[model samples]
Target: MRALVTGAGRGIGRAVAEHLSGRGYRVALTARNEDELHKAAAACAGETLVVPADITSAVDQVFDRVEAAWGGVDVLVANAGAGSSAPVHRITDEDWSRMLELNLTAPFRCVRRAVPGMVAAGHGRIVVIASVAAKRGDPYVAAYTASKHGVLGLVRSAAAELAGAGVTVNAVCPGYVDTPMTDTTVAEVAAKTGRDPARVRATLAAKQPVGRLVSPAEVADAVWFCVGNGAVTGQGVDVSGGAVQS
Candidate 1:
């Protein structure tokens, strides 16, 4: 199988790419950072192609390059996303737009671009890395929450549309993950509340019922399940450590 993973330079994306590659899939790693892409490619156990491009605007270019290297992508992991925290009333227009572009619109464009090829081939798997916010609301992150919800809707609708095409679309919604992104969130909360960064980090971890932050590899495991199961389409598989029971 051939796979293309966006934001494959690090964190959940990197974990997914490495996992698929270890399973004998030829993977393509794409992110905005060329150096990081190369480093990620080097860590893959199987063959890899590194394509560095901003997913929001270069979806077509990334797919075209992948198509040229391999026949086409058999698995598409839309895992590139960003989050911003602000009171609902204080959220800026730019921040809202950024969240939507990165979290929702980019995945939609990727799904749209990869569908025709998958339909022709008669089999494919697409997983979007969403969040617990996609399932329920959280304070100080209205824009981020809205974007994740929109992406989950996209996954459900696309899965329904492609149900008969041998294509599966799903979302993996995770809670606070132990990653650089979470580190940023910790720092931001500490700066805002005048609390120690360690305390802020611990508080975020406590939000999950597991009493710890989710691992990138754990989220990758959920993505693997989505790809391996043919009948599990249109579902948001929560990797939130029991924080989300629905």
Candidate 2:
């Protein structure tokens, strides 16, 4: 199978690209940073077409390149997201709009562009990278939480509409992970609480019954399940290390 993953320069996105590549799928890696995108491609075991474009930007060139390389994508993993720890009142309009564009709108656009050929071929998978905060009411991340919830809803709606076309749509909701984003969040928490960074991490971990941060590989595993696990659709699998259990 061939796959296209956004925000694939690092962290969970990079991990998914690598994992899918190792699984013998031809992968397309996309992000804004060309250097990091190439670095991610270098780690892949299978073929990767590097397309560096910011999904939030809605760049025409990005979609053009995808159509050129693969004509149609078998799997489209909309994993790009952006956020900050600002409280609702403290957040500017710019902040909220940017978050929505990156986290919610971009994925919708991706799904729209990718599904036509999927319908033609009679098989496809679309995985949205949501967050545990999508279910839990997170106080300081109002925009992010709202956007992720939107992603989950979109997944369900699309899955329903695409079921007859033999396409599965799902979202993976991951909690704290040892990624650059989590690093920034942990550091910010430490600075705010006047606690050590390790203590901040532990506090986040303690929120999960698993008592540890979720790994990128774990989240990737969940995405793969939706992609290949038989007869599954419209599911939002939680990869949050027992946080936000449903």
Candidate 3:
């Protein structure tokens, strides 16, 4: 199988590409950072294509590059997103726009570009990397939460639209994953609360019954399950270690 994974330079995106490669799927990795993409590609088992572009701003180019490289795609993993926490009064237009573009609009564009080819082949799998914020909104990240909530709705809509064509679309929502993003947030918390980074991270982990941040590979495993197993569709499976039960 061939798969297109967005935001694949690092974090969960990188893990997803590596996991798919290990499963014998040729992976096309998309992201804005060329060096990171190359680094990630070097870690994969199967052939990996690097398509460097900002998926949030230049989705059409990304789609064209992947479609041209692979001829068509069997799977699409819209896993690139960002997190922003702006208070209700502190939220700026740019903050809202960038968060929405990165988290929601970009994924939508990837799906839109992939479905037609999938329909032609009569089989396709789509796995969107949503977040626990989609289900449980917290303070200071209203816009980010709203964007992920949209991702769930998009998955539901496409599940119905693509089911008849033998295509399945699903989402994986993870909470407080242990990645660079989480590291940055933990550091920020440390700075704000005047505690050690480890303490701040531990406090966040306490919020989850799992007693730790989810691993990138764990989140990728959930995405792989949804895409590799065709029986599941339109489902938002939580991989947050029971942090946000739905």
Give the best candidate by TM-score: 1
- Clashing pairs for model 2 are none
**Which TM-score value belongs to model 2?**
0.96
How many clashing pairs per prediction, in order?
A: 0, 0, 0
| lDDT measured at residue 109 in model 2 versus the true structure, 0 to 100 | 90
TM-scores, each model vs. reference: 0.99, 0.96, 0.97
The local distance difference test score of each candidate is: 0.96, 0.88, 0.91
Off by over 4 Å in 2: none
Clashing pairs in 3: none
Q: Per-residue CA lDDT of candidate 3, range 1-246, in tens? A: 899999899999999999999999999999989999999999999898999998877878877887788788899999998887767789999999988899999999889988998999999999999999878879999999999999999999999988889999999999999898888888777887799998898988888898988999999999988987888999999998888877
- Tens digit of lDDT per residue, candidate 1, span 33-138? 9998998899999999999999999999999999999989999999999999999999999999999999999999999999999999999999999999999998
